[model samples]
Target: MATSSDRHRIRFTVHYDGRSFHGWQVQPDQRTAQGELERVLAKLTNGPCAVIGSGRTDRGVHATGQVAAADVPLRWSPHALRRAMNALLPDDVWVADAEMAPPFFHPRYDATSRSYIYRLGLASEADSPFRAPWCWPLLRPVDLLAMERAAERIVGDHSFKAFAKAGQEERGDRCTVTEARWAPWEGIGLEFHVSANRFLHHMVRYLVGTLVDIGLGQREPEEMDRLLAGEEGLETSPPAPAEGLFLTAVTYPADAGTKPPRRRGPQLVP
Candidate 1:
């Protein structure tokens, strides 16, 4: 067995189309982002290799800047390991960057914040098969002003028990949202960008759903304040579909480790 000193920790920035897997975590008899990476890594190392993601994304949730970490043999350089993994990983997944990390780096705990984007499709073309899988095709106009006002209500620390799925209350629901906004997305519709220190299960989706309702004039923007206050007798709108959500980025301290060099993109072997 290799001693602890023989291993080197590597951090990776990953992207994946979520349509093909259950989620990011491993599961019994089901495909997952972590499982696939571990499978390929174990083969390369000739033994078991554990991978830890910055956080879990639910089924059908995509990612363009997710972060993960693993300890590997010191012989494998960051660039070479990235190339090898991309060669073996499934078509839907790609490693955008990889680099050496501090010995005790933990993707989740070390993260300063995580960002997510939720796409809304309001144009007719959004109904096309090419676009439907990546965004919510509501096909209806929404009050952008109302949504904006409501999103502003999210820009502070608050208990998000109203937005998150059950079972996480014990972990504490307070999240310090650093940024939140809704903006145009190439004229197709609106896209919501939010960044926070941490997120609870389905919290972003629920927020999107309620915001959409507010945009449609079904509810007032002040409802966001009531929800954030954890007031009783008010239920949040149903969570938006998972397919429309994407994990966009994860930030960390400046001293976490050296940033990986810029690469053109992932190159896969045919």
Candidate 2:
């Protein structure tokens, strides 16, 4: 139990390659971001500490701007915490920044929006070995214009029940998607950017799969409205590969910080 005087809140950011991790949350017998972080925090503070993340990411999901918060009795400078944690965490996970936050602040509840980026390579050759672990490589050609048109259909608030995966029936399927678009990137790749108040499990990937189907002529763009309108008979889309997915950014109230820190190399844990 926490005593009144033991209350101390800290905020931090983490970057991780989800390919090597089981997921962000700690699980029994699985190496996860939360487990690694808690281990380091316990060693540093010489006691148990609970770390709360802004969101839960699935296996093989990557995050460049994941945020978490924890309460601990030990008081260490943010730089020190950053250095110490980086040393203890594995090379695949890096601590970007750590700072004090209002005691009432909670990473999950305080977040205003979250952004995700999905990359699709439009080339006949396989992706380079170095980039293979972080991107989805496609050899088949994709119709870029068709993908963009289908993507536009998902913008705005709607009941996304059809897009949601099975076993999420208890939670309503309404989601307010503020932005959804795909744009050509440099060379032979395209990027899909989506921002929302909240997301259903595998929502972005499902959307990507749906649009990719449209690009491939497997489905008509007009089918999107029926899908959104709770129509049945439309086939479920396949989730885009996890490697190309990244949790890019999370927004909070302005007072949380004017800007997030720049990405840097991993620090050594104490």
Candidate 3:
């Protein structure tokens, strides 16, 4: 029978360079965030262990505050486990912090919201190798006001079907977005910050793509509203490059919560 003495749950705050991973979810023969964690954990425990993440980030999508949970043998305290994992983990994946969690903790289901940041390079300097991999180097000015207006339209509850990948309709596409805004990035570009109760596949990317079009004057800002309303024949713009997206944080209820860090200017990708 399972008992507290048998295994303990640990919550982990992780960061990773998405360029090196296939994605967050584990797949047969694919290198993924979860797969790496499980592999390391299995070696530590001398058996299989599963790691559950707050959500699945697509390929080439980075993360600074991704949360995950897993069960480890009772001998491995949170601190020791974290230290051990870091010692064995690869350079691109890191365990920023680890703590005790209730045995019932489930990162994905317990999360109250998730936040993402998408970076865009509006200047020629952004083309530098160091920055280009982390942002879309458009090398042109965009109408910030137009993008802001379009973002405002998504700041409340809405059916985001048009902005998501199809085939998940059974779960519905309604998302309650609490915040969405554009901010100046580290003097090189613009960044979009968005927080929501839930996100559908490619929702943020589609939103960014569509908003970028509006900012570029290729579409009207009002089109955001039309997409939310699911106007017939109206489709979202192509998804933005996955390289520019980052899973910034995940939030949960007060007792189980990990509040997001103070909002700041976008930081350089490590």
Candidate 4:
């Protein structure tokens, strides 16, 4: 059980299905994961509390390893916290695990890398019903080779200004993408996985959208190279929808292994 003063900083691994919720961040008059999380934490602590997420995920974006941290005044055991939160939270969300962390540890700042996966699949009669929310349903067949070629062009450090969504808040559109690849998803669809130090708003979706165009033969794969070389006003396709995206994982230094509570599924708030 957590007692007052032993209620130290705790981290959480939260997962959600982005189809129903507005987004990960809390907003007024909207049902967000953060808002529901804070509500449960406040009830447990008997006071108001706030949690800081590793990053903001856009509306309709899912997360399998979304990290968040919060400070509580009571020292509640990880199991106890998980159980209590599960009892109070809705079925859409639940705590996966709970662990203590160093006082200096922060989920957002200490993260070294963040990875995301996007699913693109053609709608077929044999598709699984469970995967509908996580995979984009495309009516046309796509050229897997073209997508792979275009994906290679995005691997490496570069000023991604051409791919970034306009009006995103950032110093600039530069990002170091250490890994970017596309692969077939069990003969049903395509999957894109990318890892980066950080990402701008709608960056992955925009990139996926452009690559999908390449796969559809709407654009040549080599055009990606030109786009990376600071091409301006070349008219790219709109970004893919957010529903197919998921924050898959976040890596940190080994020393910062203070585990947070984990939630297996999305939690709905009343």
Give each model's whole-structure lDDT: 0.89, 0.80, 0.88, 0.79
CA deviation > 4 Å runs, candidate 2: 1-4, 124-126, 255-270
Candidate 1 lDDT: 0.89
Tens-digit per-residue lDDT, 205-270, candidate 3: 999999999999999999999999999999988999999999999998755524333333211110
TM-score on alpha carbons, each prediction: 0.93, 0.90, 0.92, 0.89
lDDT of 3: 0.88
- Best candidate (score: lDDT): 1
**Candidate 1: which pairs clash?**
none
| Cα-based RMSD of candidate 2 | 6.1
Spell out the clash pairs found in candidate 3.
none
Question: Candidate 2 lDDT, tens digit per residue, 1-270?
Answer: 222365566788989989878889889999898788889999988977778888988899999899987776656777788898999888888988888876556677668899999988776433777666676777568787888787888888998878877888787888888889987756757889999988988888888888888888888888888889888677558988888899988889956533343433211121
Model 4, 24-49: lDDT tens digits are: 89999999888888999989888877
Backbone N/Cα/C clashes per model: 0, 3, 0, 16
- In candidate 1 the C-alpha lDDT for residue 178 amounts to 94
Please state the error at residue 23 of candidate 2 in Å.
1.3
Runs with alpha carbons beyond 4 Å of true place in candidate 3: 1-4, 257-270
Candidate 1 vs candidate 2: the lDDT winner is 1
